[model samples]
Target: MATTLFFLLFFTPFLYSAAAPNHNAPQDLVRSSCINASYPSLCLRTLSSYSGPTGTPRDLAQAAVKVGLARARKASTYLKTSVTGKSERERAALSDCVEQMAESVDELSKTLSELKHLRGETFEFQMSNARTWVSAALTYEDTCVDGFEGVDRKVKGDVKKKITNVAMVTSNALYMIRRLDESGGLNR
Candidate 1:
């Protein structure tokens, strides 16, 4: 009976200790720790840093826009080349990305123009537009990302470029939405 009690006490602690380490396992220990320590705010801050600004939502949006423009330009070139002679799926993806890019540019331009005349009540419309634009951009990005999945690494430069362009346009749209959100324009 004493041996049983001894084993229970000794083995239980060892078992617990072993399990504890698993929680701190190498796979995602660092990420988990950081997330636990900071959470949503920290996540936002980290994302903002990608644009070289403080944790403000506007900065995050701006960063996304800059990245999108650069990516879209590159992708546009590739898309132009790949669309010429490609499979139906490839052609469809390229076309979709291009369309999304055009939409993003149009939305962004309109938002910027609206911002010049923005009043308190008008902010709501601006916010709504921003959200819609961002959502569309994200959708386009998803399509492009999915299209590239399982594609041969040796895919032509043009194909890769189209994918990149779509990604950039989407990214920029997201940034614009973030900016609107941060500006307190969408709070209502």
Candidate 2:
């Protein structure tokens, strides 16, 4: 009986350790982190595909950055190829707006690279760089919308909607990155 007890005590921990980490942990982390975002629903939607039950926060944050980068790029491409406005003045504004969106894509790409390069020793610095890039990307998205200020309502509305989607995702990525930074989840 004593031998059996010893074996139980010694092997129990090893058995437990061999099991997988809780699958729900990552989903909970995602929900808790997104609670503090400017647009919680948008954050959740943007990350829903990546924030799985077995997800790691660092992975989640990185995925958000990558997805946001792709979205920014797509929006920029659409703007560049689409014809806008009925007049020369409107066309000029639309062209400038496309350039802004292109810059926004660049910023998002930088944010993704910053997130991917995160190191425990340089976590703060990396996060700061990501935050700055995301902020600038959001600003560029906003500026694109603003460029349509004097255009016709239909044109402005259509352009604003498209740019706003990218901006919201960028904002969500920033919030997720902030969670990774402040929560010290990068090293996990």
> Candidate 2 residues 1-188, lDDT tens each?
99999999999999997795876677686677678877888776667666333266677777777767888788877776666436776787779888898888888888877776778898888888988988998988888888887787987787788888888878888887887887787665
Writing each residue's lDDT as its tens digit, candidate 1 over 46-140 gives 34345354233344444445445555555655556667666676677667666755665555555444444556777777667766765665565
Give the winner by TM-score.
2
Model 2 stretches astray by more than 4 angstroms: 1-21, 51-54
What lDDT is reached at residue 173 by model 1? 42
Compared with the true structure, model 1 gives a TM-score of 0.47
Best-fitting candidate, scored by lDDT: 2
Worst 10 residues of 1 by lDDT: 29-38
What's the number of clashes in each of the models?
Answer: 3, 0
Q: In candidate 1, residue 106 scores what lDDT?
A: 58
